[model samples]
Target: MKLQNATVLVTGANRGIGLALVRALLGAGVQKVYATARDRNSLEAVTALDSARVIPLQVDVTNHDLVSRLSEQAPDVNLLINNAGVLSFGNILEVPVEKIHEQFDVNFYGALNMARAFVPAIEKNGGGAIVNILTLVALASMPGLATYNASKAAAWSMTQSLRASVSDKNIAVYGVFPGAVDTDMLAGVDMAKTSPADIAKAVLHGIETDLEDIFPDPMSTQLYAAWRQDHKAVEKQFAGM
Candidate 1:
């Protein structure tokens, strides 16, 4: 979709990929961007990028009421980017049940909450797109990040369902699967990571090009190519990581 003059709402825009996305949207000449975080004050840096264009709002995506209210407040939004996420390091069997729930709340349900609340508003504005920020591991199980993988995999499935459900409504759903991003979320991981700025730019390009599934970095593109050839092999490869 054309981003120029598009009104967008980005969740978790206070830092990392979310913050980078806000910058990219502005650079793409979007009319307005509602940059949201759990605490509105946390968005100072993001809003500072363009005080006139960036409107900071507080939202806990897990809270259905807050998301519903936010949708009402941002009635002009045509694009919604579900970028809020949380990660925990643990194997499925060894991970605390609460930890799994915590990750799912932010990574899976949070995205769903925003989608449900915003789809109608987007439709009202004559249809647009919903971009769900997922991960490469969602396609293959990684032992160390079992819960994070499961939650995002569920979201991947949801993205497809959402796409089918909204196809005729002029709404598009894009799933972004990026490999290790150099964000605070992966600060401790020792791997070659793509900068968030690059990922943000790529994601905007994917949307403009109408790529339903986006691999925003070299690593993700390479892994996705391998997975399509032999997914089981990819699973085994990730199991050892």
Candidate 2:
């Protein structure tokens, strides 16, 4: 769908890829962007844009009631970006189960809840787009981030399920798999990471191209390519890492 005059909602708009996406949408002439964060004041960066165009919305995606309220508030939304995510970097067996549940709470169920709440709204406002910001870990689980991997993998599965069920409604579902991005989330990672701006730009391009699965970075594309050849090889490689 065209970005100009699009009413977009981006979760986790306080930082990282979500923040970059908000800026990119504004640059693409989006008329209104509902930039959401758990803390409303954290959306100051979006206010740095045209305040009239960027609406700071306070929301905890995990909260069912709040999400319904927000969906009702923005019934005209055309583009929904499920970008609110948290990563717990550690071995799953070693960490408390609560940590795994917490990751799933935000990363997995959060996206699902948002999708469920916004589907009718999107369908009502002429078919729109829903972008789920997943991770490379969904393709191959890493040793250090087992919980995060599980959460994203579940989300990736749900993305496909959602697409199959919603495409008939004319609402497009795009699964975005971004590799290591230059963000606070990858603070100590010793890998080459792409700029969030570049990822955001590529994502918009992918959306325009109507790609169902969007690999927004070279790293993600490369890994996906490898997985296509030998899924076992990629799994073994990440398992060792």
Candidate 3:
């Protein structure tokens, strides 16, 4: 889990939290980073961060074949970051079923795809870590973001299962739960938000300190504390949001 000279691969690295993570990794002195997006051209800025260390790749995480091929390309990847995600706004009953499916595909299945492809390689390389960028809402459903909440919650469960499965393999699985961030993903939301850079730094710090579950932002940290005290109360609060 040491960041120094670690070769890492991060999905959806073109912008937002992923891009911030890439920059943070560079600052931490990582040897190389495979930054992936659906479009290679969209990654120009990310690659420009450190042209030599940042290797841009085009990949749709939903595509099994494409995700599977990444392991072959980045055989030296010891750290994998499952950061690609999608969001849809709607109540569960009224949301378009297709939109629900799309969110699940990216938020849940995409992380699974990347983990499946990389875990073996990481094991071969003598242990490493898999970081899943989940959300605070995963622990409590927000009515407005119904589908997004469900999908991320499922991923949170998967992250735990993955951790237990790989416990003896020397692979560490870290789940990051962040509250609202100032990113394009929440462009119009009028709420106090943490910067993606701060979230990225916190995530790397969690890994270095061996924190299995990371609440990266202030809001998430406070909310998680409340949830631990009374999860049902927190659930009701989110339900009304």
Candidate 4:
């Protein structure tokens, strides 16, 4: 859907890519943006943008009751951006099981909860869009981020299933596979990283163009191209990274 005048709800809007998306949405002239975070106080920056247009809500996507409440509270929401996620660096075999579970809770189940709770609201509003913030690792695993990769891969599969389920309802489901972004999530990563602002803008552009899967950054764009040509080769390459 067009960004202008659309009422949107963005989960995990306190910082990083979520914050950048809030900034981009406001700049894009969206009518109202409900910026949600696990803590309301953390949304100070977003609320400061425009008190009237940027409404802050305390929402932990993993909490089913809270997400249900939010769906009721924000009935006008036409776009749901499921951007909340966690990253834990570790090899799959040695990573703490809790860390793996934590990643899945926020990255996979959390997005699923948000979609389940918000789909009805969006449908009532004559259908809109659901943007699931995924990662390039969903396509291939990186050794150090194996747990995180697994979580995102599950999310990626869910995104596809959700799209098929909602296609008849006119609600567009988009999976955004971005490469390493320059956020706290990748604070010490030595690889080149794209700025959150650039990624956010590219996501908006992808949404406007009705792309089903968005490769928002240069790295992701290149990786996706290579994967399409020969996914196994790309997998082998990432395996050696």
Look at candidate 3 and tell me the lDDT of residue 130.
98
Segments of candidate 4 deviating more than 4 angstroms: none
Model 1 global lDDT (CA atoms, 0 to 1) = 0.96
Q: Ranking by TM-score, best first?
A: 1, 3, 4, 2
Candidate 2: segments with Cα more than 4 A from true spot: none
- Tens digit of per-residue lDDT, candidate 3, span 1-241: 8999999999999999999999999999999999999999999999999999999998899999999888899999999999999999989899999999999999999999999999899999999999999999999999999999999999999999999999998999999999999999999999999999999999999999999999999999999999999999999999888
- Evaluated at residue 78, the lDDT of candidate 4 is 91
- Per-residue lDDT of model 4, residues 1-241, tens digit only: 8999999999999999999999999999999999999999999989998999999998999899999999988999999999999998988799999998899999999999999998988999999999999999999988889999999999999999999999998899999999999999999889899999999999999999999999999899999999999999999999898
Task: Output the worst ten-in-a-row residue range by lDDT, candidate 2.
Answer: 88-97
lDDT of 1 at 198: 100
Q: Which stretches of candidate 3 lie over 4 Å from their true place?
A: none
Question: What's the distance in Å from true for residue 100, model 2?
Answer: 0.4
Clashes of 3: 0
Worst 10 residues of 1 by lDDT: 86-95
| Per-residue lDDT of candidate 2, residues 121-160 (tens digit) | 9999898899999998898899799999999999999999
lDDT of 1 by residue, 1-241 (tens): 9999999999989999999999999999999999999999899999999999999998999999999999988999999999999999989899899989998999989999999999989999999999999999999989999999999999999999999999999999999999999999999889999999999999999999999999999999999999999999999999998
| Alpha carbon lDDT of each predicted model | 0.96, 0.92, 0.96, 0.95
